[model samples]
Target: MYTFIISIILLVAGYFTYGKYIEKMFGVKEERATPAYVNQDGVDYLPMSSNKNSLIQLLNIAGVGPIFGPIMGALYGPVAFIWIVLGCIFAGAVHDYLTGMISIRNRGAHLPELAGKFLGKVMKHVVNAFAILLLILVGTVFVTSPASLLHNLMNGKVSLLIITLFIFGYYILATLLPIDKIIGRFYPIFGALLLVASLGVGGMLIIQQVPIPELTLANLHPDQMPIFPLLFLTITCGALSGFHATQTPIISRTTQTEKQGRKIFYGMMIAEGIIAMVWAAAAMSLFQGANGLNELLATGGTGLVVSEVAKVTLGAVVGTLAVLGVIVLPITSGDTAFRSARMIIADYIKLPQFSMKKRLLIAVPLFVISIALTQIDFNILWRYFSWANQATAAIALFVGAMYLFIARKNYWVALIPGAFILYTTTVYILNAEIGFRQSLNVSYVAGAVISVVLVILFFKAAQKSRAAELSLEVDISDYRNIAS
Candidate 1:
């Protein structure tokens, strides 16, 4: 209980302290007009109030990942608390802010464009494909998840196929239309649903006065998954996801000024961290402890645990609403994934986005591909999706580190986290059941060696971007001057 409460308090404090410092270090200027103001295209790049932007940013990044990931992570005991609090403050929020601000600084450049600018041309193409695949996977996974959940809620009276088509129809419409029309409008309503669901369970825990597991270092994973890499991987979206960086460019374009960057980007991520912490505690508390939670998870998986938990914790009707509210997490995030897929394809090919036909030209094919993907088993697809999500973060972290290095700021802020994520992804890839099937000790040593090499690569890229920054001629000296 102390851990849970203190973690939330620390996140708020993190905002004014580290969040403010990072904002200033990045040199967010009130005087500078954002891309939204500079290139108001009503379609994707339109300005909005900071309040709405904040909510959109929250919902965009807050998928079932936080809710689901932390619930699973809670099985690791209260160590999840440490990861959520420290990871959000130092790693996740910083990753999102830097990437988002970098997008804003570069006239709403997407993640691939940002990587290309800092990491070099070769990486540009690599990350471009990487980001698109991850987004597609996200869109696909997001679609199937909510549809299945909703179908189960209705006792399969409503076919998953119909729910899926209806949802994908929304994604197609949302993708083709102007930003302000569908997404910018109803996303907040969905956002409210997610919040109420989170707070509903959260408030119940408090009212019931359930005893959250005390903070401990014990490795409670039933498989005896290592506390370091597996816990980090299992809890990717909640603590820090490269996935959020993809979503960053969306809000980067809509933001009114650079001054709002910290609030929307950094602050929103902190909000997710709080949401994650609460869910983690509630899952643990409601299960009578992490062990019971893990046993249920082994038998039933995450979705079943979710429905059972919501119905048990919040009552029947409200619980139905809460569970559907949980469904809102994926549906909202999935469409944005498709929306981002369209935007990314347009940006990559340099296609004009003003016309509905042009947007459809890109979006129709993407949605078809996503619908095709729905045929695959969810567990199989998610294993790859999970890796893809963190791998994206690994790249974005490097991009941010490279940007900071070019700016002559403390690149350590991003570099360390990037290196750590790189190690986790590497370790998991080599050692997981679906992976290369290496022994644990072998993978551990390999991950550590690779992690060090990643750090070395960071230094090399920093130096590389130093000369490249001058040649590219994008102004970094304002931030550079601030760094001094």
Candidate 2:
């Protein structure tokens, strides 16, 4: 409990501190030469309404990854907290901020479009492929985890079919509703419920005398455990995430002020980190060892984990309410995932050029795939999804680094976070031994390979940008002479 509170405080404090630095360094409030970048007609580049942009940005970015990723990582014990805090700041937050700003500058272009503009067609296609795959994996995880939790809550009496119907209904509402209306109404309600549930669960745990696990850096079954998978889980959320890069442009297009990007992007990531900490603390407080934790999860699944924690803290009824809260939170997140997938596929097919019926046709298969995948074990899907997510993050960091160099040659400060992410993810890959000594389970290895290739492409783009700048300067001088 102490650790959770401290983690929240630290994350909030870090947001204000580091966020202010980004605000000052970037000067997002400065007037642009033209408002073309900020304002748009409708489909691709709609102007933001107001400060609510920040809230919308928060709602879009905060999701199940932060919650389940951290809880699952906590299997290694409390030390996992360190990775969550540091990685959120250095990797996740930085990638989000840069991606948002870049998107805003590029006339609300999505990441793939931006990649095509800056990195070239080949790279753009590659990024799009990676992004689509990452979203599928994320959607799969989101569906499976919550469904598993729902199953546990109903004591496995709830058939997968019923859960699927409920999720599809939620996704339909998420799609049909306006993004702003949904967020404006539900975010506060859901957030408040979560706060109450968290507090209630914590309070009940104290009253019920649930056994808190000992804090230790000691390894559990060191010989049996593979080093790679452990490291992969430890650094899961922090390093390179594919899903974040895709969402960055979505929020960027909705931002009112470029200045708000730092607060909305980094602040949300920090909030997610804190949420992860809370769940991790909850898990730690409720279970003793890995085996015990496994048994609890097997019995109640992740849903039971929350229910039992709440029951220990609040009482049976309130605990069940808390479990319900837990289920709703992820379901909300999954809805967004579904929405994002639809948007991506819509863009992929250029369905705006087609009728609305055609767009729905493209969207149906994607939703069906998500629903089918949801029936499986969420934890397994999350493991693979996290790896692909890191790969995208690495590419994004490379892109951000290039943007900084192109926009302001002296702005090396912007690269600090990127450098840290590269270093940590690299270390995580090199030191860890993944399952069967393969790279598939190791995000660092995957991220490193992708990062190296992107870095090469970035430098090539920078060189061409310099040449174009020089040519424009020469043409301007000639035009000035003609005017004189």
Candidate 3:
């Protein structure tokens, strides 16, 4: 209890202290006009209330990730609490803030453009392909998951095909409409239900006096998954995810001032960190204990555990409401994945999105691709999504380090996390289900060597960036506003 309580306090306090420090370190200026106001075309780039931006950013990133991921992480026992609290403060929130601020500074550029600016053109091209594929996977996965859950909750009253079409229709509408009309208006209510559900579970746990799992380093996982890296991957969204970087540009185009970046970006991540903690505790307590949770998880899937937890904790109509709120989590994210995909496509083809016809030209094909992707099994989609998601994050973290190095500010903030994540993802690929299938020992040795080399490259690049800053061929600032 003491560990959990202190961790929460540290994260909230981190906002005023570390969050503000990062904002200053990145050179946020009050007088600089943001893209939303400077490049308003009444479409993608338009000014919105800071409050609305915060809510959209929250739902855009949160989805079912914080709830579902943490529920799986709990199978590893109470160690998840430590990871969520510390990871959010030092890594996740930092990643989200810096990436968003970087986008703002570059005239609200998306991740591919930002990556191209900081990294080289080759990386830019690679990330462009990566960003599109990942978004499609995310969009399709979120669509099917929610539609299927709604199907189950209704006890098959609604056909899955009909429900999926309805959900996909929502995605198309949200993707095409102006920000304020659909997403900005509806997200707040969905965000409220999400917060209420998580908070209600927390309160019920305390009132019922359920046994909260004790904090320990002991591995309680029945599958014996190593905690060093698997925990990091399993708890991807709550701790750090590359997916958040893709979403950042969506809100980036709407920010009114650079000053709001910390609150809108960093502050929302910390709020998500809290939501993760609340669900982790509730899942453990409601199952009687962490050991019980591992047993339950072993027998079921993420969606199963989440539905059971909500039904058992909230109960009756409120439980149903909470489950509906959970449904909103994925549906919100799925639509925005397409929205982000649309922005990427517009930028790629050098097309503007002011007219409905132009927007359809970009979106029509993207939806067709997503609809086909939904046919692949969920487990396969998730495997690709999991690795692709973290791989993107590792790349984003490296891109951030490059930004810091080019500016000649302290680069350690991004560099350290970059290397750690790089090492973990590399090791996971080499040994886990997806990659080379090498032994763990081989993965560890190779990962360590590569990580060290990457660190060395970062420093060398910083020195070269110092020498090359004024002579770069691309002067992106010349048309930053008129372009993406």
Candidate 4:
């Protein structure tokens, strides 16, 4: 219990201290115009209030990952709390803030464009393909869960096919419409429900004095899976997730100022960490122990655990509302996942999004692909999504590091975590069934070698980029002297 409370305090304190420090390091220019005003296309780049942007950003990235992931992470005992706090502070929030602010500086360019610009042109193509595929998978995977839940809630009065089609239809509308229309207006309410649900569960746990175990380094997994990469991957959104990179650019376009980046990007991630901490605590305390939680997970998965926890803690009426809030999570993220995909494609093709025809040109095929992907098994899609998601994060962190290095800021802020996640993701794929299926020791050695080579390459690229910028500045100075 003390661990959970201190962790929450640490996350909040991180915002005022580390969040502000990062903002300053990025050199926020208050007087400068933002993309929202400079590129007011009415479709994607529309000015929005910090409050609205915060809520929208919260819902955008706070999908079921935080809830489901942490619930699963609880199987690792209180050690999961350590990852939530440290990862959220050093890695997750930093990743989100840098990605969003960098996009804002680049006129709200999506991750692929930024990755290409900072990392390399090759990365641009790689990330473009990678991000689009991941978003589609996210959209498709999110669709099934919510549709099934809604179907269950309605007790099959509505067919699953109909629920899914309706969700896909809504995704189309949300994707094609202007940002302020459906998403901006509805998200605040959805965000409220999400907060209420999370806070309610957390509050009741404390009020009832649920005996949440104190923090420990024990690996309490019933299967005794190693905690290194799997735990990191298992609990992503609440800690550090690459998926947030794709979402951040969406809000990047709508931000009214550089200052709001802290609140909208960094602050919302902390809020998510809090949500994750709550769910983790609830799962740990309510389930009796790691063994009980594992048994429940094996039988019914996290969804059943969530329902049971909410009903038991918050009671029947509010529990139902809390579950609905959870339902809203994936729906909101799914819409934006499709929306982000549309924007990425539009940005890639250099198509103007102002025109409805142009928007459909990109959005139509994306949805078609997403629909087809729904036919694939959910577990298989998630396995790929999980790896792709972290890989994207590693790339984004490297982009942030490159940006910082070029700007001559403290690049280590991004570099250290970037390299660590890069190494972890590499190790994961190498050992997992999806990849080479190598032994863990082989994965560690190979992942270390790969990461070191990549870090060296990153430094070389940063040096080249820095030298290019320096040359341009010198040329400009000489031209000014000539003009004088």
Candidate 5:
């Protein structure tokens, strides 16, 4: 009981401290100019629709990651929550908010294009490549995780091929359908199903008088005492995630008011954090440390932890419903992934004569590749994906630093986040023990060194820009005085 209370307190406090701070900083001001690009598209660029509530956005953005990451974090005991909450505040929310706002201000341009404007054409392509690689890694992991869960629920009766086809077909439908119509109509139905499934499992656990084990700091697993994976997963949005960069912009493009961006983005992310906490609690309550680890390994992914919890909490019937709900969330994520990837490709490669066709062409192959990769081990894939995802986010921090230097004449705010992410990610890379992990670590080390170099270059560029502006102002003032 005390643990649950503490978790809730931490979540609420973090939300108020970091989430609301960002909100207050970017809050609506009557005199502030409406971003020009946002004004141009009244149809798509309007503030969030009145019909759209915060819950739908929450469900849309929260995927299997939130469920699984926390379970993995729980392997390290209660200490994991500290990193999750703090990381979300300083790293995750800031990235989501700034990237979303920038995209909105730049006429729904995604992260890569914004990077180009701030970082230059060469760095722009570098960032875009990084972003795309992150997306592919994220998309592939998401695809495999849920498919594995679905396969288990079907008692392994469903062939991987059929699962891939079903997922691919769903993406195609989501893509062909208009964005507003799909999100507005289908998402609410899916969200409600998820709520019912989660609650149903909870209700059954209560009715069945299932035993809740007494948790203690001493009882925590000693072998898995490492904090870095918890740090890695915590920032990944079961606790917090860089993937929110893609999600925030999608929500931003549809938001009805500039103010609502904070509400939607932060609100949804917090809700996800809460969901992750609940799953972590559920895992602890349902299984012992070794059992939980074995279950995750036996089922072939972390998502199985949620399904297994539901099966134990409820009977098979309701458990099946829980599995289906789990599947839907990732499907929504995949839909978003496909759309975002298409948007990225469209922005970078002009196929003016064949725009829609070009986007579909890019999306289909990417989806196919992702589905093929789904056959691999999900745990290993997730670890790689999380690291790659953070690396891209590190680059985004550099871009944000440049923005701050240009607009505020102070780069400390963005620089601090960038530096922290770089350090944490480097620690993660160095500690990782995969095959060729050392080589990968060296690459990231090199990347971090380059990021620091770029930070210096950006400051120089900002100084030149400021100098030119000052010169123009002085010449104009002198001419006016002479004429007078």
Candidate 6:
């Protein structure tokens, strides 16, 4: 219990302290006009108040990952607390703030464009495909999860196919309409429900004095899954998720000022960390122990655990509301995933998005692909998504580090976390069924080798980027002097 409370406090404090340092390092320009104002197209690039932007940003990134992932992470015992706090503070929030602010500085470019600019031209195409694939997977998973949950809630009275089609239709409307029309308007209401759900469950657990397990380094899993890479991958959203990078640009284009980046990006991630911490604590305290949690998980999975916990803690009336809140997380994220895909494709093709016809040109095919993906098994899609998600995160962090390096700021803030997650991403695929399927020792050694090589290559690119940036600055200064 003390560990859990301390972890939450640390996360909040980290935002005020470390988060402030990050803001300072990035050098926020309050006077600088944002993309929303400069490029007011009444579509994606329209300014919104900080409060609205923060709410949208929170819901946009707060997929079921925070709830489901932490519930699963509870099987590993209180050690999950450590990852949620540290990973969120250092890697997750930093990745988000940098990505959002950098996008604003670059006319609201998406991750692929930013990746290409910072990482390399080749990475632009690679990361483009990588990000679009991740978004589609996210969209498809979110749609299926919510539709299934809603079907179960209705006791299978409603056809799953109908619920799914209904959701896909909503996604189309949300993606096709202006940002403020569907997403910007509905997200605040959804954000309120999300808060009520998490806070209600977390508050009750504390009020009831549920005995949350204290932190320990011991391997507490019933299956004794190694905590090294698996735990990191298992808990991404509340800790650090590359998916947030894609979502941040959505708000980045809508932000009225650079100052809000800290709140909308960094602060909301802390909010998610709090949400994650609460769920992890609740899952740990409610179940008999790690063994009990594992048994239930193996039998019924995350949805069952969520339903049981909500009903037990919050009662049937409010628990139902909480479940609705959980449903909201995925639906909100899914729409934006399709929306981001549309924007990314439009940007890639250099198509003007002032008209609906141009937007549909990209959005139509994305929805078609997402619809096709629904036929694939959810678990299989998740397995591939898990690695790709973290890989996307690693790349985003490297991009952040590169941006800071070129700007002559403290690049280590992003570089260290980027390196750690890169190692995790590397080791997981090498050992997982999806990738090379190597032995643990082979994975460890090979992952290290691969990470080292990549870091060296990153530095090479950074050096070239930094030199070019410096030359540009000098040229600007010289041109200014001549004009004067």
Two-way lDDT contest, 3 vs 5, winner: 3
lDDT, candidates in the order shown: 0.84, 0.61, 0.83, 0.89, 0.63, 0.90
Residue 464, model 2, lDDT: 80
- For candidate 4, the per-residue lDDT at 253 reads 86
Query: What's the true lDDT of residue 134 in model 3?
Result: 92
Worst 10 residues of 2 by lDDT: 472-481
Q: Which residue runs does candidate 6 get wrong by more than 4 Å?
A: 217-223, 470-484
lDDT winner between candidates 1 and 2: 1
lDDT of 5 by residue, 183-227 (tens): 656887788777777666645555665543334667543464555
Model 3 residue 357 distance off true place after TM-score fit, in angstroms = 1.9
Model 1 CA lDDT for position 330: 88
Clashing pairs in 3: none
Candidate 1: tens digits of C-alpha lDDT, residues 80-105: 88888898999999999998998988
**Candidate 2, 1-484: lDDT as tens digits:** 4445555577778778876676566556433311223343343335554445554554455556555565666676656666677667666776787777776666555667666655567877887777777777776666666676787778879897788677777676665455555654676667666657755655555566555443354643233555443544444543235577777676665665655677678777776676666677667766766677778877756556666666766678877877776666666656666666666666665655234465467557877777677665666666556656665676676667666666664334445555444544454555434333435445566656765664566567777866665221001111121110
- In model 3, how large is the Cα lDDT of residue 318? 86
Structural RMSD, model 5 = 6.7
Of 2 and 6, the candidate ahead on lDDT is 6
Task: Write model 6 residue lDDT over 1-484, tens digit each, in one string.
Answer: 8998899899999999999999998998776777787667999999888999999999999989899899988888888998999999999999999999989888798999998888878999999999999999999999999998898778899999999999999999999999999999999999999999999998898888889998765544435568888999999999999999999999988998788889999999999999999999989989799778888888877888888888989999999999999999999999999999889988998998899998888989998998999999988988888888999999999989998898888999999999999999999999998999999899999999999999999999899888877321111111121110
Q: Please estimate how well model 6 matches the true structure, expressed as its whole-model Cα lDDT.
A: 0.90
Name the regions of candidate 1 deviating beyond 4 angstroms.
217-223, 468-484
TM-score of each: 0.94, 0.80, 0.94, 0.96, 0.82, 0.96
Steric collisions counted per model: 1, 8, 0, 0, 11, 0
Winner of 1 and 6 under lDDT: 6
